[model samples]
Target chain A: MTKTTGVGRPRASGAAASKREARLAVLDAAGELFTGAGYAATTTRAIAERAGLRQASLYYHFPSKEDILAALLEDTVRPSLDVAGGLSAKLAPVGARLWALAYADIHLLGSARHNLGALYLLPEISSPRLARFRAERAELKRVYGSLVAAAGVPGELLGIRTDLVFGLVESIAIVRRDQPDLDVEAHAVEGADSVLRLAGLGEPDAGLRDSARALLED
Target chain B: MTKTTGVGRPRASGAAASKREARLAVLDAAGELFTGAGYAATTTRAIAERAGLRQASLYYHFPSKEDILAALLEDTVRPSLDVAGGLSAKLAPVGARLWALAYADIHLLGSARHNLGALYLLPEISSPRLARFRAERAELKRVYGSLVAAAGVPGELLGIRTDLVFGLVESIAIVRRDQPDLDVEAHAVEGADSVLRLAGLGEPDAGLRDSARALLED
Candidate 1:
């Protein structure tokens, strides 16, 4: 269901292709404007202009500016959640699986054209429109917590460790936002290492890194 | 200079005290609105209403909403920077010093009535009006980097490690924003421990915690 391109829109092949193109354009423009000129300041007209579409056309793709934001935020977390879900079924060590999740998540945040994860801090995101995005994020956080617990962090403060691991990985977005010239690959390793260390798994050894890489590839 | 209340706003003692009170009211209102409804969505009029002041009175205290935002952002970082600066001169284990800095930072973020540090993610905060805040934040990051380096993290990725440690500490703001019922004091210890671990210091021992407490008390 989540992968459906258009279940209700009946159109010719050419029309459908063009509609998808316009939708992507709207998303790209909204991503830039929302992350650059603050979400509240970015008008639908401005997004339409940036996307090279009429305002009405932009609304045809996204019902409102909040919808655009929801799409962008979902784009940021969906891949990470997918990875986390897949990793759960794997037979690898908890530390290795956690490292893979962090690495993939960091890479996703760093490679985004706009730092959309930073938008998570925007107060407007608390509105009901973004509830799905919030729930997905909470699910991802829960996955991180479960993984950290499986990694056997010896403490009465395991919940805190879980929170720190999730926060540390998400912090990559702010790092990328501030340091546009940062080396994403290098930082991804550091982020994953920090997550493991925070979970009391210590640094990622060569074997652990190799195992994480294998899991990621799988 | 940063501590000066009002160098040029010379008024009668009664008027000056009331003006100072108004300025604080403006800040308080801005903090709530900006962190709740978002900076771009908030207006001077709304802030004035929230603070029980006329719009003109609001302008008398803050020339623009951007100025109000800059003040709030500065409030979030100033105490942490001061604590980091003071810790630098203390003769103690680098681990303890770093722990003290992290604990203080986490405490500050958790204690704010509104999650103003989360405002750092707003795109509008990139304006020139916030340059001083940005510079101060960079200075804070540099301090964290220097402290992490001094803590003797090995490998060619010291810069990455430094960024992660700093990012990890700041991510506490997001943690608090998402989980409002969190235990600030217990999580502060976890935050500090994660910083030390990320810097390769391992879990903070009791001696390290005691030393950090002493430094914080001082």
Candidate 2:
């Protein structure tokens, strides 16, 4: 009797785990569909079909297509901001912080390249939604701006001229993605170093080395 | 009788000149459409219609859509290459040349943002046609590489990391196009100067301003 009861409990636990996995599968399918096809062109039914789930089941997981996108953005953006903030707290000297920040950024972009494509295209399809996303992005930029300003460099003189450092990093990643023959990791590290140096960040150091290692490890 | 004959000839010449103007108008319309909608999305008939010409008339001027794009690329690419080549010729010392090259690149991008977008997007749609375009771009990169190699700066140490400099400049310009509020020119110049200094291109002579101006103006 005890053995029979234990077998039933294990089966019940497995069923619960599968349900969780299915939910994650739905989100992943939605992200890929939205990025590959323009957001406006993608539909909830399509995402559900791609996930091999009923449309009603997809709705059970996500209230709407926008909700799925918002989840993907949160998954990508929140960790990026958190990692950046944590790195900034630990690294001393403005240069080290900047380098670490760049590494974190590149890592985020590399992991979320597909989702980012959707994010970039979103602006063309839905301005109000893009505006909300940009607001979050702007907050991240403010953190970077403070670090640049604190480096005892005049913003104008440093020629760290725009508030688009993050955007530039992402754009380069897109180019690198399109060119598979190129050594993308090398490009990302070198590109990040160049931009940091441009912002009046002094010479490269072990902190940068560590940051690059950490970011590239995955 | 002589005065009457002169009037008739002048009118004939005027009509011929008007026909030439109409041909140019068609080309311009086709270019704008191709740049906006891409080569694949644009149709010869649509281009002809936009130009206020019969579809058959477009063939009289150009063979196909590819021809129109080729014409646009040829017209724009040559002047840009010339500007880059001209800068390398004028600036003495590798560091100054590097700075001038960066500024010239930014200026070129600003003027040809639409063309650059088309250039970037073409690869995704047509690999065979893009091959020739990529070859031209690779030659440009080779020119930059030669300039860096000629600087006699050891690769192991100071100076713009030659492999990454061009990528950095390209990324910045791409980002600036998406964010119009940014001061791309100033940032590009400063970024170049910093890279040069870091790469050990010692600062230029203050008194050389007159010589620099003369070379540029000439």
Best model per lDDT = 1
For every candidate in turn, the CA RMSD to the true structure comes to 4.8, 7.9
Q: Mind giving the per-residue lDDT tens digits that candidate 1 earns over B70-155?
A: 88889888999999878877899888888999999889988788878788788776799999999999898888888888888765
Off by over 4 Å in 2: A1-77, A111-126, A158-160, A163-168, A181-184, A211-218, B1-76, B87-91, B113-115, B118-126, B152-163, B181-188, B194-216
Candidate lDDT scores, in order, read 0.86, 0.58
Q: Each candidate's DockQ score against the native complex? A: 0.79, 0.17
- By TM-score, the best candidate is 1
Docking class of 1: medium
Model 1, which residues run further than 4 Å from truth? A1-12, B1-12
- How much is the lDDT of residue B108 in candidate 2? 60
Candidate 1, residue A52: how far the Cα is off, in Å = 1.6
TM-score: model 1 vs. ground truth = 0.92
